[model samples]
Target: MAVTSEPVLAIDVGGTRMKGSVVDAAGRELHGCTRPTPRADGPDAVVEAVVAFAADLTARAGGVAAAGIVVPGIVDEDSGTAVLSANLGWRDLPMRSVLEARLGVPLAFGQDVRAGGLAEVRLGAARGARDALFVPIGTGIGAAVVLDGRPVSGSGFAGEIGHLVVDAGGAACGCGLRGCLETVASAPAVARRYAARTGRATPVPEIAAAAGRGDDPAAVAVWAEAVDALAGVFATCATLLGPEIVVVGGGLAESGALLLDPLRAALDGRLSFQRRPRVVRAALGDRAGALGAGLMARERLQAGVGSAR
Candidate 1:
């Protein structure tokens, strides 16, 4: 059946919150809602919450034809299983099957960062680029690599760029590594490091402003360290993958050039015989995940791949 005219449900399941939206085939949202993720209550509780939230949205949308969901961690989209989400505390959960049974519809599932990358490529900053890197820096950092205009999953474990070690002897990471990029480069890490040095808790934006203005030595040092760490990663990426553009998103990317300009400069300072990628801020912002989910659902419908009944 050609159900392209019907609306579809899209959900982006984050560690701390779940965002849902219903969109028509043209990708314009018809309805949307956000709910707190009860992660502290356990993984099963989080799954149940997703089901309930999705159900409510479906009903509110007057019954969507299908649902598209994206989440963090290791996700095997081929099998529709959430391989592992340390934040959500799940391993090998058959999420798509469960959701199909509960929601009574076929759906599409994907990793959140990859989904965000897709949205940016199709509709946002990375549009018209054949190869790009999409990295969203928030509570943690993750990358989505687009090669030949398609996001590569590497069998569900590809884009763990946050775990890449930058300071091998520095802070311990939750993933049992020392001095991973996320520990020093993420938004929270920047603020935490600033507080530890200055005895004052300051956000990334303020720290960035202070660094740019050269007013605070602590802020300058902390921000410079983060930008340097990220530059090293991007330099390595430029050498290995040679992406034409790198789209930086999430809360930290909101700093705009305060982040990208320094990052581009630091990356250039490191690269001598490598392809330099243009570092740009993501155009979709936080809604990229949900919009990507909607795109996935519409693609599923267009391809005649119905969700498991």
Candidate 2:
């Protein structure tokens, strides 16, 4: 094994695609690419695709010093295993070990949302906050909680706020739970709910636009439900965690003031003595996960762990 200053290979695995980058020690991306995840081909194929992606990235980088890979699901960071991912259809997969063997590089493996949160803390919006929450509400809702400047994993099952019961009688969630926050606040949920109400399938962005324009009463109602649900969740999180800031990311966050203004107002109305966390949009956009993966790889390299086997 040799210690080198070579850039790291970072990969962020999503349900739909896998993003790869060769990132320098400074966390700057040197090269990048994206590939479709072979999820339709089954879990085994997804794993193979990840390995192939890493190997290709390593080669493109002329040899990476280390690698970081983040995926969605119940990821046991300590064990370097992806326990389960309903979207990817995998279970108890030892992703770190497999990638290490296949790529012949030291690897850092973690959950995607957690990685994004870490990235936000280390290099983005939550940089100075010791207590913070990063919630990315995309096709689904997931969160990353940082306490005392470090992410709280709860042994990989910690941040599933999306499944929290915000509306006990609202709607059923994919997690087999009724009235989950995700049912009301997630991007897909907003689109679905709007379609269900209007008998017209409108994308979330369109609904948000309509709400912004104040033209469609149905759109306004749908958006309000999402904002209200989100505010409720934020209030609960504030009561429990006392986060100084809540960084909102993902597709929904793109609505900017359209989402944040109403959310902030609603959240303020709900809080009594709880510290009102400043809710803001994520600074990293869709690249947070990939950048976080890079940061994880660099940290592992600096720690001298995950040495090449």
Candidate 3:
């Protein structure tokens, strides 16, 4: 019997860290590691780091055929370049070719949220939903709109839900917009705004805990605002996309029902004329992005072999 080999090396690049693993045919991560990104080193240095990360996984896998990299930004998949990434200081960079030659394997790349959404829609939360939205709320909020178990990357920028203006005259955002959803709803926003109000150096987990105890007014208010902002975004997406479910992931989802219960109720309350889909948390842990990257690699491998004939 001929021994078959592993398919691909998956790499996920975030604003602060890098993660990688080798995935088998069954969507299992065979080897994995997480490391902080030396982001200040510019795009060239980042490319080298990505190449090295994928190579390490390939070596550990004993052997792998190809690689996939998921990045946070407006990635022009057709150009195989990162159109721009505000967090990473990237611009029109040819990342795939650089990593391809460096790792000596065929490379597949995609926008991080889109890739993660694909994984969830196909293998995780919204598996059978005809239409779904995968939203990850952390320092920022973004989503992948899944249509028929596949992600729809509109203008390569469709899932930028965080930029939605939930408060027309509220707080200013890094994107130079006022009252953007991220300013009020993201985990960092929840923590920073709470700290600003209470003069306490509390983290997000502590803030959620304080809210639970009913001992912190600022925590409760901030948490509610975050939930409300999220509700606004969900309402808009539901009205527009009509997905069967909204799969929530990222650090904010860690709040469990604290985030979900209110968000679902708020969304449900707002829907007077349209059907409301259930808002649910993603089943995967922090490794969701890396797992999605692995699936992208596997998808690319399948596509390659299919086209070879």
Candidate 4:
């Protein structure tokens, strides 16, 4: 059921870059473009970059049918508004109309993580999966829950697993909460917290290396806490959604066996009384968000065509 009409312009707005792609119905990018996020310059500049990026791709692609934009924030998908992005510094942005006007194409707006989950379910790791979870462990620990082939964006705000309060009295989160999973288990937390305790400023990969050696007390303590917190969240998500698989992604998942081995063990122990979903790494890696947005755009166009017919 691949709709071979005009391609779509896919945009994924991240803290670091605004990635753009002109993609076909089958989730293949025809032309790729990216720009650095103007964090100091603010939201308007970012929007401008997205528009320029889309225009470049559309020109290269000859034309585009629609645009799909995935943003990092509490997105009000119903209204196509970015509710707030702490990292991107946007609030209640009317993103859909802005892009539609700029790019001159129908726009489908979505949360970045949710869109990634959509990509996974449709064409990536979770294809044919009735239930699955996509968790990206990077600067933060965010998740997207997919149930029965559709992501459960509960009241437009589902799968915010990072803010899940794992420790009531732990470190304060950016959302102003204390002892959040993000505060404990995110990649930055893994590095910075380990450094704070040991007074050694090593990155997460180095910390994992030390942990693998099994002698660094700082590595043991921080990695143990991170793994425990992450496992706790996974167990809770599994207990709730009972997914067939939980696909893990983001910068931290690159740790490979260092992450998977202890994570599996901890998750298995935590889910002793519950159904344990197989926790695996995401297949698409860094491109999941962009690819996911492209998939959603194709679906939206298909649905529109179906309804019209």
Model 2, residue pairs in steric clash: none
| Candidate 3 all-Cα RMSD | 2.6
- Local distance difference test, each candidate: 0.90, 0.89, 0.80, 0.83
RMSD of 1: 1.9
lDDT of 3 by residue, 236-309 (tens): 88889788899999988888887798789888888877768888889876677777777777666667633210
Error of 4 at 145 (Å): 0.8
lDDT: which is higher, 2 or 3? 2
lDDT, residue 24, model 4:
76
Judging by TM-score, tell me the better candidate of 1 and 4: 1
lDDT of 2 by residue, 1-309 (tens): 245467998899999999999987667789999999998999999988999888888888889998899999899887888898877897998878887788887899899999999999989998899999999999889999999987788878988999999889878788888999999999988988999989998888889989989999999999999999999999999999999999999999999999999999999999999988999999999899998888888777877774311
Model 4, residue pairs in steric clash: none
List per-candidate RMSD values in Å: 1.9, 2.1, 2.6, 2.2
Error of 1 at 146 (Å): 1.1
TM-score to native of every candidate shown: 0.95, 0.95, 0.92, 0.94
What is the C-alpha lDDT profile of model 4 across 70-130, one tens digit per residue?
9887887667778888778889888777776777777788889988888887777887888
